[model samples]
Target chain A: MHISSTEVDYIALGASSDFRADGRHAFEFRDVIVESHLVPSVSGSSRAQVGGTDVLVYVKAELGPAQGKNGTEGVITFTAHYSSVTGLDNEVRTSNMLNAELEESLNRLFSEKQAANLERLCLLEGRVAWTLLVDVTVLKADGNVLDVASFAVRNALLSTLVPHVEVIRGEEGEADEIEVDDEPASRRLLLEGDPPVFISVCLLGSKWMLDASQDEEASMTSKLSVGVNSSGKVCGIVKAGEGALEWDGLGDTLKTAANMGVKIIEGLRKVQASRAETVGFFA
Target chain B: MGLREFDYGPLVSVERGTEVTTRERKRQWNELRPLFMRTRMVSHAAGSSYLEAENSKVICSVNGPLANTGGRTEAIERAKISCYISRTKFCGLEDDELEKRATTEYEGIVCRALESIVRVEQYPKSTIEVHVLVIEDDGSTLSAAITCACLALADAKIELRELMACCSVVNANGQLLLDPTLDEEKEASGSVLVSYLATSGKVSTVFQTGQLAYDEMAQAVELTISGAREIAVLVRNCLRQRESKDRGL
Candidate 1:
């Protein structure tokens, strides 16, 4: 993203005054609108329009045979596709590289010990289990895509329903055959664990901004995305873009992420609850 | 005897299993899925478009007429066209690994479809890149990608000799199906993807899987062209809307 001289100066002045180009505060985020059940074909899906950056997160659960040799818990898959919407889309290599980077950052956030509760998806101890696929699509990328995508994924999973399975023993002491419930109401709830939310902080000089827009993102020297759980614990850290940062300074920023992450989660929870007592996502 | 199985009647069409928007009546064989397209979504990219055809969603961005840094630019007469496709997985660290070969194969097809239409000689010693990403693959992905590539190219204001449009036809149970969904493609006896240069009315690219009788292929080709033309009008209108909007109309 190329910044003109005037734009650079505007950003620099904003940073000095702790104001942003879009008239946002140093630690403020743009308006984020999240809607779930955007893709009804999938098990669960949601779209998050964070300012100009729009990302759709979809969850699909599939059954697979046990893979731990003796069978273990199921797994969650994360994929982030940086579509051609970005300016670098013209460069085939750059587009591919950015898509890979997006996937890596998304995976790091979900690869933590409790990022997902896979054991609940296991139908049998060592025979059958469900593999949940989390797909993130960048429809419109205006910066801060990773954090926005993470929030969307968390929202999608909260409303996701896993199909109920009845395990029946085969005839005369044979293997167990799983039967999936046909009715939607019969499906069981998935994700009985805390969903991690990622917040990104852009460090420009002595000032840091939360949820930087594309222009601010371009001018920033460094970006750090920290994932926090409900317990205010740091689940993961993803250093995005190229920038310089002092170790001590960013640590305090991480603390900001922890505090704000909980607030963000609470905000999302409020949104979910307000919707819960009324119409659902599909409605 | 090993085991016995019972087959149920084919009552429900498979599109419902994917992303289907219910209406008073189902679309005809040659009719298209619900199409929503928007252009100029990206600031940095020269051209960009977002297209949603039913459940098949795609975003394509075009960049270039820029300098070719890669030594692979052996062509001096025409500008080089490069295509990149990024298919996301449903979940996990890795993305659509199984379709690695197929994705590259589609990239080649896209490049071939657009390379000729772009007046490469106009821009000397440069490269044009088209990047496409499939958000959801319900069906007719290649066709969606082709139309989007054209829209993005036009949005970028690239000098194009003509516009390209694409359609997917599948022959299943002796019936011609247009814009077959992923499930229909799986059940198809044969499938054909045709891209047409709408301005010249020329077939730019054709990819076929499975087999069809010669006459069936001929008839399918004609219907496929019709589908392409229908979509071409929509593509044209999308560009016109952008122009009108820019003029404050």
Candidate 2:
């Protein structure tokens, strides 16, 4: 097998206690820049740029019939598209994988039981329901796409609002009615309980690094990504790269990831609360 | 709803400008009087630029000189340049004929010019890819795309021994005009596209369609060469600005 000199250096760095070219600790993450209400025309939108990875997500709600099994409930469907700024050739495969992973992760988080509590979204019992479509796009891919994508999706969802609904009797029969006023009078999701965040750890040699760059990813032997809910629970886990991991290391990584996920959720909550008070895109 | 049709004219033609007609074409061109002629607009890439020839706006971004995934290791001295032109929504139908012609012409121009300027043998197994995304267009889009791609390549920190630029000249109503607009393009009798290297003052590529006299071709070449220089200067300025910004200067 052929490998570049950079790869060799990255492996050596991973083995040493003093890892990362930027001097960041193994558990440290790069600064994240998050912005909400980017697309004014859409119901809600948010963009997040973490390190070099960029993600934009928009939330739009439409009225549809509720499922027979899940009466008096609404639906939230998350669709993600990842496109790289670097060019189509380099990003096609990575984008597809990230999209599928993000969609699955979000679906797992917003279970039918949790969605039933959103009574304001349901128009009538087993009749009409509000379906929120969360569209996520990955414009630039430097590294850590999953984290950035999840951040944007969650932020967009937090910013989204579904209009008030009421049931009325018509001339023919009883009908479900939706009153969508210009004013922002809509219910917000209680995402504080079930919010999930993803943490990716790449094994350089014996040491694991958080938020690895594209070059570092190429050099690393294996990468373990863990999805943890707001309640410090491990929701999902996936391992990628060329090497295998020991059970002890995996267990330790999972514990570290859970702690990291909680920190992320706290940070997001702070941003969402403060951001909701603010008005304009640039401001 | 589908993509909306673009109206090139003013919202209120009588209030702002005269109506578009065959006889009023020259008058319209004379009135618009572009602020800048063939100026290089960007400067960060190995090559970067913008070609504002009349109403047409072309911005080019080039990135490479990093590595080549494929190619012979021994023949590393030469670099590979790929050109992509994003058509405007108004281009209407997406046809194979237009795409083939544009790609072939672009490949011919870039390949001929880079062959002489790039030290490809030094990096045998490597290639430099060039991508040109066109945000808007008025006329002679292909020629402008070639020029923009060259500038973007320069901005991307790629190594090129010389600067390459392209421009189009058309024959209109028995008179030759440099940088025709979309309206003029429809009525033009013939068109000549030329790509030139500023450092060597050499013509790398030339495509002339429709019948034109030898003297007419020479005149068009002369006009395009001078226009290329003006554009080269703009490209340099854009790069300088970006460099300064990057350095926090």
Please tell me which predicted candidate would have the highest TM-score against the true structure: 1
Q: Write model 2 residue lDDT over A1-283, tens digit each, in one string.
A: 2347677675656546656776778788888888887997776899989887788889898888774345767767777666646333443445344455556545544432332244545677787777778787878777777777777777787777554444565556646455654445344442333445667888787777788776667677666666555666554444455343443234566577668877887888888888665445652
- What tens digits encode model 1's per-residue C-alpha lDDT throughout B81-195? 8889876674121343443335544676677678657777788778899999887877788889989999999989999888778888887787888888776765676666777
**Cα TM-score per model:** 0.52, 0.48
Question: Model 1, A56-174: lDDT tens per residue?
Answer: 88999899865433476786777777666644335532455466656655665664435665566677878788887889888888888888898898888776777778898789878
What are the TM values for chain B, all candidates?
0.85, 0.70
Candidate 2 per-residue lDDT over residues B11-93, each given as its tens digit: 11222345665433334322222423222344444555555544566666555665767433323444555444455544432
lDDT of each: 0.72, 0.59
Candidate 2, what DockQ?
Answer: 0.01
